[model samples]
Target: MALPPNSETERGVYLRNVFYNTHPTEVFSTWPKLIVEDYAVVGRLINLYSFIEINLRRLVESWTDADLLPKGRIKDLPLGRVEELAQTVLLWPEANLFALKKMAELRSLRNLVAHFGMMRFPDDDAFLFIAKSEADYKKQTGEQSVEDVMLIAVLDGPALPRLVQELEGMAQWLATVTAQILKQKADAEADVSKS
Candidate 1:
């Protein structure tokens, strides 16, 4: 695809292509055939989380460049701190709340999955972070036991793809918002010059 004229839009497009073109599903699908099902699940989850984190940083940096956010606030801040600022600045369209919550949950899950071995699946923690209730978790996991929850049946299944889709949506939203803010800034500058 040709890059969008807007830099922020181009960044969003690039992020989506990176995530979808990587084909995480195909990469992890082969693992189970190798009898490393746990690795498949863990690996996919970590990969998804990492991609989202990277895109979030990119989006925040774009916001800073457009003057939509104060540069000093994000300087040297951790992802969590950047996310906190995002909640306030990106709260338009109400549905953004769901996106923010999902990102936060992914961050928490990423920390646990990346640091801890798969021997201890943080099912309870995952449930708390992402699910509204045990029933909701079960619904998402198809009533699978917590022990069976991290199986490829779930990770390589619908949930992973849905997450990728959500990330793409968020990238588009961020790009659109960034473009609007930058246009506004440009207009203000032009007005000042005319004056």
Candidate 2:
């Protein structure tokens, strides 16, 4: 599936850098490296979310044949609003809806990391979602508390690669769904013209 050109060039560059620089061996080698790798993972996750959101907006605009951003607008519309419009107007297919719902779950995690800055352990919801074992958490962080478990989980643990894989899969699924939607729309328009 061919996605439209990325609107966030700087973000794309930063994501590429983060991917190239982050390594599992380095992350496990030292505490400092672990922290940096954690930051990189969170940063990359945010960038992927932004990329998906932007493409979703573009897809909606193209399907509607109207500019989401007009001359009178002081600022662009929010992603939630755009998503609502897409659901209502475009009527996304079931597969697309499932994919978007999964993305929304990740969006919550992204918000927690982005807003809270990982100064403390993630909340119960995030902790459970990441699903780190107590024994493993104790061995890794030297503490048995859930807070410590969450701290390690968010920073450098199994959650990192799992979240990355989930996001990558979602991005690919969205691209394929978007391509199918566009093709269907084009075919419908052609059929109307024939009539």
Candidate 3:
């Protein structure tokens, strides 16, 4: 039986079609696959840190006792720019900027793999350049000649678990700093009010 089309249903189907059309086509070649895998690792790294970022934001949004603001490695910028929210970044005291720069290179390479092959995305040359640069970025950053990136995977059963554990440490350290900053701000305000 023929039926009349609902406007909402028609819109939903149209949106799906657009999304499928915009998605990048996968490259069957081996090099592209490796690059995509590397990109997945990069996402894991971001995922590992995301927890800390979210926690810090939640702390402020939840507005628990001022103690969570102190003693923790978080920077609470309360009441400054309600829109800014200001407590997104949390990093350990000795976080390695050098490693981050290298990782950025890897991510850029992966972007090419996902968006470029025979479509409106990244290109092969871009991926190779990222791989090559990642290999040598350590030297440029004045490190101990790092020829590879050590990704700490999420799933257990191998060395990846340990690496992921270490990465979490960095996030925790950042949280601690944030707490200190919040405490410092509190103390300063208390002093001002005393006058």
Give one digit per residue, the lDDT tens place, for model 2 in 41-99. 77888888887787677667665553433333222767666666555654567877777
How many times do residue backbones clash in model 1? 0
Tens-digit lDDT track of model 3 for 24-83: 223223223334544555466557545544544554543434433334323444322221
Off by over 4 Å in 3: 1-48, 55-159
TM-scores across all candidates?
Answer: 0.45, 0.50, 0.30
Model 1 regions lying over 4 Å from their true place: 1-35, 73-75, 120-195
lDDT of each: 0.50, 0.55, 0.39
lDDT tens readout by residue for model 1, 60-151: 77678767787675547887777776677665567876777666755544554454322311221111111223443454455745542332
Q: Of the pair 1 and 2, which is ahead by lDDT?
A: 2
RMSD of each: 14.9, 14.2, 18.9
lDDT of 3 at 56: 46
Clashing pairs in 2: none
lDDT of 3 at 80: 28
- In angstroms, the error of model 1 at 16 is 39
User: Which candidate number maximizes lDDT?
Assistant: 2
